[model samples]
Target: MNFFPNFANINECLEWVKRKDLALAKMELICQLLNHPEKKQKTIHIAGTNGKGSTVAFLTSIFQNSGLQVGTFTSPHLDDWNERIKVNGISITNHEFFLISQQIMSELEGKVQPTIFEFLTAVALYYFAEIKPVDLVIYEVGVGGKYDATNVISPLVCGITNIDYDHLNYLGNTLTDIAQKKAGIIKKDIPCFTTETKPQILSLLQKISQEKQSKLCKISPAKKFIFDSSQLITNFCLTAKKHTFNLKTKMLGQHQIKNASLAVNMVLYLQKYFPQITQSSIEKGIKEAFWPSRMELISQEPLIFLDGAHNLGGIKSLIQTLKTFFPAKKPIFLISIMKDKQVDKILNTLKKIACQIIFTEIPETRRQEISKLKHNNTAKFHKITDYSKAFFSFYSLLDNQKIGIICGSLHFTALIKREFLMNLNEKLNNFSLSNHQPV
Candidate 1:
């Protein structure tokens, strides 16, 4: 795994914008030019508004522990491009990324320009085929699965987690509309799994599956999960079928149980083809799987947490999770969101749990500048100009007995994490932060 890619010095990686161009035609051309590298491995395509990353993490850990070489392609890297394309849990090395990137550049240099997402998807597929092949590829849909760049692959199994309002402009405005976009990944005769319970959304997905001749296997959680919450870890006694499994995860939200349940059923369905994946492996893999920046508690003494709850539904979950853990108090929150997101809904949802809120923008063009926001959270709202200072204030308040949480876009979470980490390495004489406590 490489810390930084070779093109880190170049501006192409970060400067490439991911806009509203959603279609498979462009990706089809790029893959044809690259000789169709996506056919290298069998795939299980996972798509959802929230829990896609965590679900991917659970499946990756389970398959890898079963002794299978797993290749996972996820989107919106928290740190860098290398974080997006990974093989067997290791990020594609800078050399590997550079090699594939050059090949892509040569093939589509001037003949046809590719979008950032398209170029990266081509690089990942090429890397998987020509560079290093794997047994399975746990591919996550970038945004709406309908015409996402990664939707080019024909997967063996398609899984759609619970769908809600998200990507309203690109996917659709209503839940049914969004569900249709995610169901686009269901291929002809492929088996599908889902945790979607909404009647309308479920009906839409089932209809798509039937039209495609695919089997939509919906996995419903037990009547309820028995939660065991300690100081830091949260465990759930999840019962599926006659057997009960003690599932443990570092994630804070109860929604993870549903995600884990979906992963469990998918592994079970794959048993005929993959005899190595067993019940014990599933239990161990899920317990150990950790997806960063999603309910991630970085420190305890000052009690700072980070969750990438970028949308209304995600924010609601974050609030509920906090209520479950810290029943009686409000946590100080530092948030940054995109300009295009539903600002009012997100803020209203947070008013219940956020004692004090600081709104700041990551240094990006799409960031929701503090001045550009139209929010209605009645809490003690403070808008800060500098993101670093916002994070600094949140950290400085750790010792005051109020908990801290960072939420909103994953990219904003990434920037704040990077800034805080960078602040840790500086000399105390130059600047001070949270009394410099170690996790």
Candidate 2:
């Protein structure tokens, strides 16, 4: 009956990431405690080096529009904790979050230990079962696939969103090793989908798929409209065998256009098996799914933007998106990342488009040392110890004609978005009230 505190709910989860133990023991323990015999649910397990989040967003939205009750769980939340778990796009309420935390904490107190990811996965699955029994659940893997807590689900669809080096410390150093770990989601006889892949990764995936007797479908990045990011409303088209449909993405990036196709391919695959999903529903779902913080534009003056390009593949995509979207202009980057990341590679890429740069720390033990910026002379630098200071400092530099992008890590982006910018309008209203004269 004891309620968990706000700090317990937020930092408790974030702290687990630092533990760095990748074994599935904690996940299985939580599952054993909370999972009921009656609540077995089908899911779609999504894994990749990049694009899995966008893919999950697209698929989740599509399933929701298909008129099927849908549950979705994604990680590295942006702006809010509730953003990680949703039923038909409705985030779990604050009271519900506390209640679930109480239950989860009770179950894990001493009898079983659970990592933050495992604990949250338990809460999400339990919530999905109790609140609304979803016809489909789409889960984005927190890290690698094999040991990922979400991997336990019997996925109706498994997607590999293109493999690359990420979480190398745990997953492995080689691309083949990483691909193998990700391909772990391709369970026995489950249909799998992938984006256009490299030769080595594709071979690894094919071997795994064949071993499991699962059919693998490689999604060719269909030529959509030539993306003109200069346009306010960026547009594209995907031509399929039966029909060609014009598509407009709420999210920016050519990578997102490819992600939309990956979602489309998965939805089409889902329909072939589910039968109830119609073409109209598919279109509606893709168009409606909204994933924030990836190439998200916060304000125009001094042009504030944020993205979680923590890895090389994601950084490449982000750079490409920035180039396409901004065209001739350059953007100043306010960036920080985790200690474990390849900072050299990331900085090398940033130097290409970074008009100027500022160094900062994220609110975590794993945040990269701000002193690392001392070596880079290609751009200006400042070390901001806390996020509030970073935000105010970055805002001050906005010249009204230039742009500022916050990048490098998802965790950093999430904190900046939630703490500084999430409710700017509401805060401004309060400030106005204290200053205004009686009317």
* Winning candidate number (TM-score): 1
Give the Cα lDDT of each candidate.
Answer: 0.80, 0.76
What is the C-alpha lDDT profile of model 2 across 1-439, one tens digit per residue? 2122245676686676554334764565566677541247878888988888888888877777777788889888766788889888888898888898898788778777777787788888888766667787888999889888877678778888888778889999998888878888888888898884688788888888999999998877655456554544457777654657677776778888788888887777777667877778777776676777788878765577888888888888888877877775667778888878877788777777776767678768888887665444433645666656666656656675567788878878877777767786674464453453311
Residues 1-439, candidate 1, lDDT per residue (tens digit)?
A: 2222355544654553233233576787787777778776788899988899999999999998898998989988998889988887799999989988888899887767887887888888888888888888888888889888898898878888879888788987888788878888888988999998888888888899999998988887644554555555667766665667777766667788788889888888887889998778888898888898888877666677889999888888888888877765558888988877888778767776677888887778978877767653343777777776777666665554577889999988887777665455463334565464321
- In model 1, what lDDT does residue 171 have? 85
Model 1 reaches what TM-score against the true structure? Answer: 0.89
Query: Where in model 2 is the C-alpha error above 4 Å?
Result: 1-22, 25-39, 94-111, 228-231, 372-382, 386-389, 399-401, 422-439
TM-scores of all models? 0.89, 0.84
True lDDT of residue 352, candidate 1: 61
What is the Å distance of residue 69 in model 1 from its true position?
A: 0.7
